[model samples]
Target: MKILIVENEIYLAQSIASKLSHFGFVCEMIPSVGEAMQMEAADIILLSANIPGQDFYPLIEKFKDSIVILMIPYVNEEMVMRPLKAGISDYIVKPFMIDELICKIEHYTAFRQLQKEIAFYRDYFCNSLLMPTYSINTKISFPLIIKSVSQKVIDMCVVNYAIHKKLAINFISLYKNHHYKEIFKSVSKTQLTYIIGFETLRKEEKEECVKALKNIPVIFACLGGDLHDFKNVFEINVKEMTHGFQEDVLSVDEYIKTMILKFEDKYPDTELSKRLGMSRKSLWEKRKKYGITKKK
Candidate 1:
């Protein structure tokens, strides 16, 4: 990462630059905010607020997006709070150890990385849900069960509901060897927990899961029939063949099979064949090849 040191004290700036450079950081030392502003960009900015007669607020505003750590002689409202409130990442008092400063830099860098990853996943999840048709009723109670033919559809509904309610979900799939009691104990009460793959669990395991999740705020996504024991059971039967945008190109056989299976009942064979750019006989042969027999 690139580090920009904005300090009028040349000796102090060089001292910090040399130590940081040893740790594999690219360092640039500027004697004034004017010089620092002239530089192209930096990952982190170490600004010395003790620079006499220099208004450092402008520097803070210029690099507001960068990790701006103020280096001040003393902590006060004007020196610390003002800059912090104006988006300064952090502040280190003068004569502090290089190790402490580096620790702060690493901490903020990791935090920024986490924020980016969270944003990316949130966007991807929301976009994936756009293709599915589902609804979350506001009156629906927690500790609920969602029984669906498609696990993907259930996932989309539950996740989108959590997102809408501004709740963070701790997802645990029973397909893995996850201890239900241990997971229940570890999950935060303030956050919602989603226990998935309940249909895959054995009768004893399901009983154990119910005991562990009793009276807790959880949403269970089970595949197959309705769960009678659960208080609030929401059934979602999504018949859409396409889950979302396909990342990979489907093979001709796969494409033909999917089209024939999804649209065969909705359209006559001639119309279906026309849509598929093939004759009715060809569609019938393709179906036979794929072992897809129409229901009588």
Candidate 2:
């Protein structure tokens, strides 16, 4: 990473640049805020608040996007608090060890990276699951089984559960690994295990797998049909709500029925029917056939 040292003390700037360069950091030194402002962009900015007659706030604002740390002679309103409010990431006392500064740089770099990743995944999840919202059952207990017609429904339920519980999900697909049982032994107790592709296992294998997970905190996503063998099974009916097209194949009639059920309330008959590629009469007939009640 590139480091910009904006300190008026020439000797101190050279010492810091030399120490940081030894640790694989590209260091640039400038003696004033004016010169530093004109310098090229850097990943991190170490601005000394003690620069004589220079208003360091302008430099702080200029490099607000970078990890700007104040090299303060003493901690007070002008040096630490005000710069922090103005977007300086942190401050280090003078005469500090090089290792301590490196530690702060590494720490904030990881933090900023995590912020970027969170932003990306949040947008990704929002786009992937565009319609339908899910809530965890109040009576939900760990080591549960979620039975749903659509894989997407089960996925939303598990994702919502993990988020609500503030736990990370350790996803495991049975089709991909026959020895998934071994994962349970080594899995972190803090993470929630979300298991899919259980239908690929044999009857005996399913039974053994269930026994092995008896004491582990896990949620099984069983696609289609009610699983009678397991207790604490939560069924999410696909008919109750719809999320448009899905990974699972549906008959033409079923698809039409799901579409009407999902959009009937949201759109008028003329718009809804046109979108479904059918006339208002056919929409009425399909609603009748599927026994779906249209809201007044």
Candidate 3:
């Protein structure tokens, strides 16, 4: 989280910035509102109303959307009311708690998340430049590290999910040591496929992966789907969702993240292992394996 502190008091700004940085916020100390206007972006802005001439007021006109924490010298009515009227997010009286300020940061971040989710639903998803796709219910309710023998399906699932969730996603399951060992045992024979364009890959670096796929077979089958017949591979009953724009493509990792994030949004309470139709521990294992950080 990027934080911008607009304070004329250098010592005070440094103190707050140092504290906020410890709490995982990236702090930028700006000596004045003029400096803040020069910022390209920041997650939160802490502004002080110490000097004269509508202190911090002008910047609010420019950055009303930026989450603003106002520090006013007087705890009186007018000082507080002015910023509130100008759409500040929160207020901190002079000589307040560093702990208290952190609490306010957490509070506002939560509120911002709620607003983000709302806006995401209302505007972002529907307007996404997404490939037409179908859903995957692996039965695991939570995210887990599951390696796919087939890269194409992995790619498809990601794009499908990213389109649904309005988030850029990438699937990094390709570099694993194992193929999610028992996941196929629980697939239950239902194939849920999706349409995707070929952002095809296979550089010399994939020589090892190609060698491994020789043992697994599905990786080759996924890419060629039996028509190429590089080896005597048989076409299985994996589901397919064909669409017109299937030529516009994304990479495999990108597709996978898209799938997972969308899945997360769809089943907010999803126990990825079970709800996603996988082994109970599979989802948890996947998250741990991928180091997929959970969003607060």
Candidate 4:
């Protein structure tokens, strides 16, 4: 983690840097908020209210919405409250224990991350039409095309979150519940399929979803997938994948989400059974062995 400290105090900055460095964190010490403003790439910035010439309020404006924690010599309603409202992520009083400082750092850093993620999804919802389903006539555009613009913006915003930020993140937790969820009452919700086209998922993470995709009987048929082939496969044994819960197969809106994780890394799904881990005849026998019945 690259931690930025914008404190004019020389010795205090060095001491804080040393403390943070002991824990394998890279610390960048800049005496003034002005200089710190120049290196805007810092992951976390610790600002001081008691700086020379400049107040910390405007720095909050300069780096608006950044995960900046303010450190002050003293704390009161007036000082702490104002910065908090002015977009300071969290505030710390000077002469505090190192442990407390670190704890506060961890707590607020997590909160800031969550806020950013929520903002990202909100932006996505705003840019994209959250229609339940896009209907198509003969030779109509793929539904995913309409959503491509919004998805790109959201993914771009969150692209450089961290090394592993590409891992699957539940979109439900990011967005608030809607008023009319049951509006899909008429639609037969089967297996959730992420029918997206624009994004790419690392094979590994995509495969991870496939592994977790068990118990729910999900499938990943791309737009180019043979609809009839998939249908034939489904007609043969719908119950095989469903594990008997075929009626309530759910979450297709997120089905293909893992695919959007990252494009640079090529990771294969490590957990899917090898060839379903059985020979064709063996699979047939096991269906009988398990006393499973095909529904379609």
The TM-scores, one per candidate, come to 0.72, 0.65, 0.43, 0.46
Instruction: List ranges where model 3 is wrong by over 4 Å.
Output: 123-296
TM-score of 4: 0.46
Model 4, 1-296: lDDT tens digits are 88888988899999999998987789989998778767857767888888867866667887765678888888788888988788777878887778988897788778878888878765654444321111111232111111222333223222222112332322221012121122123212332222223123233433443344344322222311113311212111223223334432223323223221221124323321133444545544543432222222
> In candidate 2, which residue ranges exceed 4 Å CA deviation?
129-139, 147-154, 164-217, 222-228, 234-296
Candidate 4: pairs in clash? 192-252, 193-252, 194-255, 194-256, 200-259, 201-259, 203-267, 204-267, 204-268
- Stretch of 10 with least lDDT, candidate 1: 240-249
Give a tens-digit lDDT track for model 3, residues 41-159. Answer: 77788888885453567787777877888888878878787779999998998888889999998898899899988677545434444323334444322222123334444444554
Counting clashing residue pairs in each candidate, in order, gives 0, 0, 35, 9
Name the candidate that leads on TM-score.
1
| Candidate 2 lDDT by residue in tens digits, 1-296 | 99999988899999999999999999998898998889769999998888888998888888888999999888777667777889999999998999999999999999999999978765655555532355556586657777765666677778766766687878877645647566566555667888875544445666777777776778887653326776777877655554663455566874676576557658999999999999999988876664454666
Candidate 4 lDDT trough over 10 residues, lowest sum? 229-238
lDDT of 1 by residue, 169-227 (tens): 88876646344455566555668888775654555666676666666778887754326
| Residue 286 Cα positional deviation in candidate 4, in Å, after optimal superposition | 12
Candidate 2 accuracy as TM-score = 0.65
Between the candidate structures 1 and 3, which one is better when assessed by TM-score? 1
C-alpha lDDT score of every prediction, in listed order:
0.77, 0.76, 0.55, 0.49
**Residues forming the 10-long window of minimal summed lDDT in candidate 3:** 192-201
How does residue 246 of candidate 3 score in lDDT? 38
